[model samples]
Target: MASVDLATSYAALILADDGIEITADKILALTEAASVEVEPIWASLLAKALEGKDVKELLSNIGSGGGGAPAAAASAAGGAAAAAAEAPKEEEKKKEEEKEESDEDMGFGLFD
Candidate 1:
């Protein structure tokens, strides 16, 4: 589980650095190509959690601001909870988008 989580995060970082939109399929492909076993649910969950947000900006702020250890930990926990709450809605939207893209890529299902 931890390896899968780390794989997704690394994939996301690489995508962001390359100026690519982070998507579940892309993350999964990366993990799979590397022979990492990642749960689809986890990849999709992360994709949703990161939706509509600037990955670089989000990651850059992770340890920039200074605060007391307790306060910092508290804020981090709160932020994580909020992200979890928002992910479900984004997940639905992402699934719809992925379906549309898949259909478009099929090109009349010539080979499928």
Candidate 2:
């Protein structure tokens, strides 16, 4: 079985909703069939859904397995992708810092 990344699956659903009516059961089944962890993706989707009026109720509905509006889900997926991209920058920065420390320990500077 081909494995689907949860984020990608959620994003796909968000896009699909643009042309068709998406239901909670369909979303749940997609996530489950993907054979990957989807809790984080679901949480992100829920956050987007709650951005409107009655956050508590909105979130409660989402938590109870209700599908969010297409636009909201798409927005959430975009946000998650942006956030995921930042993670690489952080890792790169950490690596650079470690390299600089190692160089310093060796008494080597760019000028040296």
Clashes of 1: 0
Clashing residue pairs in all predictions, respectively, total: 0, 0
lDDT of 2 by residue, 31-71 (tens): 66655545545545543543344533443587555334544
RMSD of 1: 17.6
Assess every candidate by TM-score.
0.56, 0.31
What Cα-based lDDT does every candidate model obtain? 0.85, 0.56
Off by over 4 Å in 2: 1-76
Candidate 1 residue spans exceeding 4 A from truth: 66-112
Tell me model 1's lDDT, rounded to 2 decimals: 0.85
lDDT of 1 by residue, 1-112 (tens): 7888789999998989999988999999999998998988988999999999999998888985664554556568897755665677799999989987888787864356
